[model samples]
Target chain A: MFNTRSMSKLLVVASKDQLDGIVRELYRHHVFHIEDFVETEEEGYEGVKIGMPLPQASAVSTELLRIRAIVSAFGVARSDVVPERKESVSALSARIDAELPQIEAEVSDLVDRRNHLESAIRECETKIAELEPFVPVQVDLSLLRGYEQFSVLAGHIPAKVELPVPAEMYFSGDVSGNLLIAIVPNERLNEAEQFLFEAGFQSMPVPGEEGLAKDRIAWYTQEISRLRAEMEEVDEQVNARKEKHQTFLVACDELLTAEAERAEAPLRFATTDTTFVAEGWVPSENVEALTAALRSVTNGTAYIAEQDFDPVNDNVPIEFDNPDFSKPTEMLMDVYSRPQYTELDPTLLIAIVFPIFFGFILGDVGYGLVLLAMSLGLRRIITGGAGEKLLKVLRNASVSSIIFGVLYSEFLGFALPWEPIGINRHLNIGAEAHGHGPDIVLMLVVSAWAGILHITLGRLIHMRNARRMYKPGKHRNKVVFGQAGWILVMWGILFALWSMFELPLMPSFTGLSPIVAGMNIVTLLGAVMLIVGIVAIGQENSLELLELPTVMSHTLSYARLAAVGISSVAIAMVVNYIAIGMMIEPAMQDLSLMGVIFIIAGIIVFLLGHTLNTALGLLGGGLHSIRLHYVEFFTKFYLGRGKKYDPFGMIRKFTED
Target chain B: MAVETMSVEVAEASARGLVAIGAGLAVGMAGLATAIAQYGIGTAAVGATAENKDIFGLVLVLTVIPETIVIFGLVVALLLLF
Candidate 1:
């Protein structure tokens, strides 16, 4: 809760293997790296630089060390000029680490190869089934006597043609009735060709155009099946090799585990800056031994503080803590939520007013209850920071709707179905029963009153800030005769109007006569003091022209409450007219197609219109709420230009995990 | 004062027509503003990347800042359409 402007620096000394351990410790404690050795400080400007920004250092350095260590340990002999000597024991360790992974990898590769061959075996089996139908049946052409006699009459013409069987195969053909015929096996085909020639047919040689794809499928299938069987045998051999490889890998993994553990162990450091700083936190009983240990480490250069055991408790829940920001844009994001460090957080104010304004704009119980239920459901599913912020906003908005629903005396767009406990119901909107619906004029008047209070609160916040930063006496005077003064005058003027107009009340306008008069005097004094402050500010800024118009215009801006209230009700009336008109017709019929459709459409449109109106109202309310904060409230008490705090560790690239 | 009264009437009509044209040009003027703003930001982003390839992410975020104006104008156009 207390702010400290001081910064601390510490230096750590640890074994070379424990470098990562020290870095991790620093990271955990939010201690940012001030400097580091990194290659290529600027893009396209490759060089080994002594230091880089902490954000970049954290991202790039860890991998650089690991890669360098791995390369050195493997004894690749980086260069002769490299200072490190490759000893026998270290070289042996490196070989075991490298070869062992290779062995395991090779085994996995063999297993994958076998699996692929197995898939091929299935494919071959399918091809074999298809080829079975196409296998040729045995036949004899010379057996028939008639066929033999006809062959004598037919002269054999040497008709040459390329065969699909292979280029080496020959074919002879004789034509019967201009038909040319050839067979793939020329020896068996000659007798048939001779018979065809004698039947008075002419023939010519032609290239074979028939498809043999089925035959090829059978051939390839058989070949693949045979190769697959061979691969199965190979797989058995590979598995045996892999078993031996696995045993070797196990030994290497153990050695690597030992190395990793050694690398991970915390280093014993005697450095005064990092080591001795812990002495302050040591219990009183252990003070002597800790000091003795520290003396042995730093040679007594360490300056240590001893204090009584009064533990500072930082037990605040994380949700309540101000969000950690490491970049400039985060400051703007904070403004969107609330300036938590400031006395007044705008988000907290927005949570109160935004929903109320939306409810007034909507003015329907059914829609409000539905929205409230939806908001509550949606809040649980939200995950992102911005999404969560939006949910928080909606959660408050829904609550406002419920509150306004009560005021409207309508539930689920109908009169509350249950009996009233204390307050009497005025009208049942669902039944279309009119019993003097909420007085629009009265709503506007109340809206203005609320506006006055909100504006006053904004101005009060600003005044408080000014008081906190500068002279309290002058600020306190302004708060009374300046901020409070305007609020009083507004109330007084409203009361006087009520009195003059003889507005409705049980006691009547004349009841508070003395109070009204006294308020008028106070209002006058406040008006004077405010004018003086304005003139003084104008003089300071050298913009006296801005003083009068700005003051007058800003004060009158509160009247927008009345304007907006009237507009909201007018919109609702339009919707109501639309909805009710849907239920009626020229014939005044009880049941009609047009009437039903109209009713359905009107109900839908009415809900949509009210919801949209409510959304717009919420936005306006939120912005005006902020406007009041920025111009009136924050101006009073906040010094907004203060630099925000940023403690650094990880620089997460939002694109990455 | 005019020798030709019809000519004077034509001139008045022309002036009114010109005003209507000016109104139509308003959208184009906003578009021009958006274009100029986008170009300035886009070129700066390109130059930044040229200096440092690693700054692509930062450059992309920065480039989108000026695009907001174009988006706002687009919204206005959509509102007009609807």
Candidate 2:
């Protein structure tokens, strides 16, 4: 349960003619993780090079590209269609051969028409904007342009100015600026331009259309509407095509993708003039089945053998073999990294502990129900992927929250009828009538104890990992001793604190007589353990001795479990106090139209306040809980960077054999 | 004699207020320190995440590692207040 699945090195040798059969069998079995071959110039490796892909690879790729283009043109998304049943490969191939070209031609033609209409619509809109500035002038568009002897200047000017030469000018005034048009003789154009430049004139080119500006604008608007109608028609045609062929396109895409992968599989193999060799990793239990499948496919011409390899030296891909209950936690594990084949898998431990931490932080019945409903609702909508996996994790966390909520007797910061069966988080901030206020102290101590236990578990796991990684020797013994020293140090700190302070739930050793000076027997024992632990750790690596304070600090870090929970509870109470005590109660004292409005506003406030708090609770509880594992807990032992096992196969959803 | 008794009462009240202020400062200053530490780390983490999205988890853990200081300060404040 703690280890990844065992893998065996698989080597398959076959004649060149049987390469196709071997590839087919391997892909169907879906157990091989092929390691690509690299050419070498040493020894008997002459003429042994990486094999070329099958001759049909190029054709398959071309067909795959064409299908993809059609699929994209139709705007078909995978989620847009649900496959009713798996399609037969032969039938799909025949359909592709018969109908793909017609579909492609129709889609391309419609797409071209759509593109043409869109660009034309954009041109008309641009023309309309250009003509809009001239509408106030009320001049002919032909008169604004096509002036040879007279230079026409038209644009917005700050104010009217006298031209240096005699010219015909039109002026219009508005809030933005004055629009002006001047027709000056070409002989004196430079003098007129210089005079306009001084008046802060921003010039625009006269549009190249004929007739009145308003008339041309009206024509362009009508043209735009007509083009838009045409565009809509093209879009409707495309949508119809999408509705008709979306399913077939999605299936064809899947089938062609698989075919392309199969055709290109030989590129990973090592081949000579007569034979090819494929090397890969397979799960040990499936080795026999795979060998049998290969034998049947090649008619005894292929040779399959299990090659011995060292787990330490070889690059064995790691596949998690966790039980179904703990499988979803692999998402969390993957966020960090996959565990090495030889390393201990911590998925089961995380699965058990992570949700507990989440529940402890957000222990409230109302919020728990909200989260549960949200995760379950989202899970139904998002079927598969990281999002679905995350929702599954949240489902587990919400269930844990419900359990903790029951124990805490908290329902959205309101006290339940029955007394709290667990730590009374509400009591920390003056919920004394409900319970004793010093429960906060108890909560802190419990969190510290949790930290101690969690860190000790990490140390033990590290020791186990050390034993597996190293042979019994001075170095291995030192590493194991170092981990043990950390455990001892944690216990020593706990014992010392217990002896010094009369903490809740802890037996006080303060009553005992002093063994040395003011130190009691328990205190002396704790001191001795601390010294010995430090010595052992220093012996392993003296630099680690500097990190002695971290043991105390890391233990204190777990106090956030109580601290964060208390803060959430405090916020929830404040929200209730404001919405009910400050607003609704005042409104209730007097009944008027304003009072009714105030009451409604108060209800809105309550709902919004609770919604914000719930979101905050999820963020705080989830991030903090997972952070504890990733930062504080995993830092103790986890050294992950294992290769993921990706077998050579496709799990077809839309197509079948 | 009456004035002396009143002065003693005033002294006790002020002492209590100081302790409260001390607790607040413990948490506040630590939070500020944590913010300062996270500033540099957060910017670099964002840059790294932009380049490669897969390291988001690792960067998140790194970004929050300094938050332990704030938690430590909170523990101290809790010790002082209750």
Candidate 3:
């Protein structure tokens, strides 16, 4: 399509209220108009009026409501969906005001409960700390065992009596064998040790024997258990408080949501800093009322003027004007950007090709079925209407895979015992015993044909878009020469190759067989087409011209079809061989269980690997297909320079959150 | 004994080769991802700067966004080597 751009400017002077009314009207119609009323610099700001067709008013209303619901649900503050009704906003304001006290009360109660629990925990911790120094302790048995040679110290020493009671009693930390430790800092050790063990048990201690510190260690141990129990109780209380807070938060959210949809009986005008001048199309009938309203709000400062409206140009790329009834599936097409809608809606196209490619790459019937089932199941699991939309795409792709798998005549790692039902069994080319398998060639050729078709359709879209934007004459060459030229060159090259390598010597040139000689002659025309189409479509950018070879190479790159098919077969063969080998001896010995297990394991592995490969293959193939469509195909005639439609009354700043 | 030792060394050599190959693949993928992510973020950063020069500090932080991916890769590679 030829690129067409038009620029216009408008200015309006009105009271703040009238300006706001105009802005609200513009937002209701999805008309993007900028309000440049900055108190600071305002040099780049200009007003523009975007037009809408009167016939689409209801559709516009539905779309606006949908957007509003989505923004409300998702918590986005974009009010441009439907102009916020003044009555509703004021009602919401009143509700927020009424609910503020209750919300604050609940929050205060939660905070109080949390604080009480925290203080209780602190008091428990303080009590535990006070008792920590007085708990009992046990002796280290390993250290005691190591010093067991001095076992005579186990029992009480009766001032140098015969060997004391058994060593076990002392090591077991009994009080009978417990000795008083010196109550001394290092400086008074001599005096303190003499006052205790030195004076009471000289024979057993001999000399330089230190008193025991068991009682002190025991006191700390007992305190630890007591503290742990107290902390655990406090923890339980804290958890209960946290749960209560969570419940309060949930209630708060529900309350706010209910408030948004609540009915109200109020009509209050909001004070405004918002000011806008909008240009919009109305049925010449509504223009009178619109003007009257503007006059009333502006106190006679507003004006209405007529401008030519081109519905086709306004919604170019999107077929919103008069949709073709024959295309029932157009409802599935989603526009990422309205202005670039026509040329850029490649997502649905990608959705169609991705699964087909994935299944082909994977090439395992069992795996394909599994993927279909998995996707369908996942779709069922997803909740909400939005989830259902995502599921719809997955469901479609799964169906495509199931179809492809049936066509491929594969089930698990084995070929179907009989031809699939419904498909003409006798005429099935896929199952024919041609060394490379007739289906592989058929599939590869189809892939190439799909590529050709994609490029052609993209060109057609661009041609329509170009003309719609009023650049019909400039892109005429692309429709006639550029598009048809590439198609011919591609087929011509194929025909020439077939004739050179595939014809029978002579009499073949008889009737329809001079097609070879004709092909040779057609090769020159094809070559010329290849050159002209490339040059015309590329728009003469030197850097883009460098991409010519890359695009051309990828056009032929569907050869990966053969590569993927061969890999699938090779992997299957290796796995099958290993399985058979493992089971051979067992089968001979009549160990059917082992043999069966081997076969099952082998199939599972083959299925798993092939399924993964196919999935990845489909993704790569689909993305590559779209890349070709967007860059090579659309570049032929389409120009994507339209600005996206983003209405005002929305924040333009990006926060990291 | 020599043959056994030689076989052991060969096996170790192959294990090391596998590690090297895996590391190379991991690093290469990470680098490519970082480059793509950085290109998008960098473009946005430039656009932000064009809108407001005062946001320069924020712009610098956003521009460094892709560095994290590469740093993760580097850390993984270091762990594997050690």
Q: Per-prediction fnat values?
A: 0.00, 0.58, 0.00
Q: lDDT for model 3, on a 0 to 1 scale?
A: 0.43
lDDT of each: 0.44, 0.87, 0.43
lDDT of prediction 2: 0.87
The best candidate by DockQ is 2
Best by lDDT: 2
Which scores greater on lDDT, model 2 or model 3?
A: 2
Candidate 3 displacement at residue A10 in angstroms: 11
TM-score of decoy 1: 0.43
Which pairs clash in model 2?
A: none
Chain A TM per candidate, in order of listing: 0.46, 0.96, 0.53
Model 3, residue A320: displacement in angstroms?
8.0
lDDT of 3 at A219: 44
* Per-model TM-score versus the true fold: 0.43, 0.95, 0.51
Considering only chain B, report the TM-score of each candidate against the true chain B: 0.58, 0.88, 0.80
DockQ for model 1 equals 0.04
List, residue by residue over A1-657, the lDDT tens digit for candidate 1. Answer: 111122222333333333443334333333232222233457653432222122434333443344334333322222212223222435546665576456545555665677778777777766555433322311222221133222221122344433333222222232222223334234445655545445444543221112353555557767886877779686667756644443333333333333333233222222222231121122234345544554445555544344433121211111122222212222222443323232333434544455565555444455556666766677667554556566556555556656665665555344565543322223323445565544534443454456556666766665554454344575455444454444444454544455445543212354344444454443444455555555445433445334444333344444343334334444555556555544433224666777677667777877877777566555544444334434433444343332233322332211111
Give the Cα error of residue A643 in candidate 1, in Å.
4.9
